[model samples]
Target: MTWKDKLGLVHIYTGNGKGKTTAAFGLAVRMLGSGGKVAIVQFMKAPKAYGEQKKIEECGALIESFGLPKFVHGKPTEEDIEAAKRALARAKELASSGEWDLVIVDEVCVALGFNMLDVGEVRELIKSKAPHTELVLTGRYCPEELFELADYVTEMREIKHPYQRGVIARRGVEY
Candidate 1:
């Protein structure tokens, strides 16, 4: 039997702090090392020069980003909505296809908070996942209803951050 035959659970990483994606990627690396298939659907983030992208690709995991290059602050534009919808659709397909052992929806909570995707749709996606396919959702502003549905929920609380001193995101560190 393959690793996919084992039990799979829903995991949510959410908070106002950093490391949600980092934690999820860490697990992805672990799962990949065990010869499991992983698919990451990144929402609100286009492909960039992040070091993790290269490493994840090299490790044989599929990673797809759906978003414009710019950051959305106030109101998301039509393009942002379209990209988020596409990302959700891709995530749903991956979760139920039985091709991947683990599916990560990166920054999906942020997409929901931005009103780019519906919470009910996300809930339905989670419910529709294959019984053996692990599902991971990462980002800030996770809805309370989702928390109730998750088997594991971790909140990364920021006690201190370099950004408070006007430090910008560093390559291979923050990205």
Candidate 2:
């Protein structure tokens, strides 16, 4: 309801590399293992194709996806923007409800980087989150403001990625 009621845990995973989403999902699974309620807010992807999304669904956590499908480097359309806004609203409600122990915002920084949402709005949502909530945010090129607000930050620096060799993403590995 107010900033004083907000949580203390936050993490940011960023950089031009793989495993940001995977790492966050791992944390979510770990929290679930400990009998914690969880929610995942997916940005720039859907629930249909991702392995992690499917796994979380079967595990019974609340998982929601937003953003439209676009090929790499494609610009977002207006519909995609609206979906992102809707997803943010849903995430805010969940975060403020004090229902989830862990909440992951996958690829949120990428959405902000594309100007789909404002950093201030996201910061406000984080500020309004419930006490004891753990927010995990993942994406490349995270804004410094988000980083400054984070209690922990991890950057997945790309050393060698198969994408450079034209390797398609393998299910269970990338997705």
Candidate 3:
């Protein structure tokens, strides 16, 4: 069914702290509760690598994840670049298809942070989304340039964190 809202707005969740993806997933569930269609294209994360992957899929949201098994610290490898390109292409299709009420580009800012994807391409992806599609972009290092295109921009600043105390990312908590 087509969305009946007045408009679909762009949302950005970015900062150093956690919960960006969590917030996006929260909104996904909220939209699904009302029988809205959702699609999530994950960048820089491999398939079935995160806890939410299976659960979110079980909740009936379409999930597409792409990334190399290893993390990129400095210059990204050719595989990393290619994977992100594919993810962006799929995200572009979903965002502009008008078949989904919400389309999320998860960890996109991290891909941008690593230079795996171009900011200009991302800007165009946002602009090309269907007028009735609600878009949510999640991850850290979100460029200031994107804020102007969004209707809602929330930053999850890190005042304190378990990582500072030498804690590792716990499954189901950080992943």
Candidate 4:
């Protein structure tokens, strides 16, 4: 029996800070190192040049992006909502496929917070996940209800950040 046969749990990473995606990616790396297949579904984040994305691909993991070209701040456009829905649907498909050992839903909370997706849909997706597939959800503004559904939840609190000092995100560091 493989390690995948012995484990499958829901993990949530959320808060008004950094490291949510980083933490999830770290876990993905660990899983990949253990001979497990990993799939990442990014919501609300468009396809772009990201260091981790390249590394994850090189590590033999799949990464799918469902987002617009720019970030949604004030109000999300119809295209944004459609993209988020597609992301959620793809996440559900991957989580239930039983082919992947781990499935990471990146920026899902942000999509939910932007009203592009529904909490119930996410809950259903979690509930319907394959028994042998571990799931990870990451993003800011996580709903309280999700805490009750998740097996483990980590909240990243931002005490300080370089963005606060007018420093823009650097390449390969904060992409």
| Candidate models: Cα lDDT each | 0.92, 0.83, 0.92, 0.92
> Model 1, range 1-175, lDDT digits (tens) per residue?
9656774799999999989999999999999988898999999887864789878988989999997898898999998999999999999999999888899999999999998988999999899898899999999999999988899999999999988999999988988
List ranges where model 3 is wrong by over 4 Å. Answer: 1-3
Deviation from native of the Cα of residue 122 in model 1, angstroms: 0.6
Give the Å shift of residue 175 in candidate 3.
1.2
Candidate 4: tens digits of C-alpha lDDT, residues 51-130: 88878989999999988888898999998999998999999999998999999999999998988888999999999999
Model 3, residue 58: distance off in Å is: 0.4
Winner on TM-score (1 vs 2): 1
Clashes of 1: 0
Which TM-score value belongs to model 3?
A: 0.96
Instruction: Identify the runs in model 1 with alpha carbons over 4 angstroms from their true place.
Output: 1-3
Q: How far out, in Å, is residue 133 in model 1?
A: 0.3
Q: RMSD in angstroms, all models?
A: 1.1, 3.5, 1.5, 1.0
Error of 1 at 2 (Å): 5.4
What global local distance difference test value does model 3 have?
Answer: 0.92
Residue-level lDDT of model 3, residues 1-175, one tens digit each, is 5354755799999999878999999998998898888999999888898999899999999999987778777899998999999999999999999999999999999999888888999999999999999999999999999999999999999899988899998998988
Candidate 2 accuracy as TM-score: 0.91
lDDT of 2 by residue, 50-124 (tens): 877878878868888886666325577788888789888888888888888888888888888888889998897
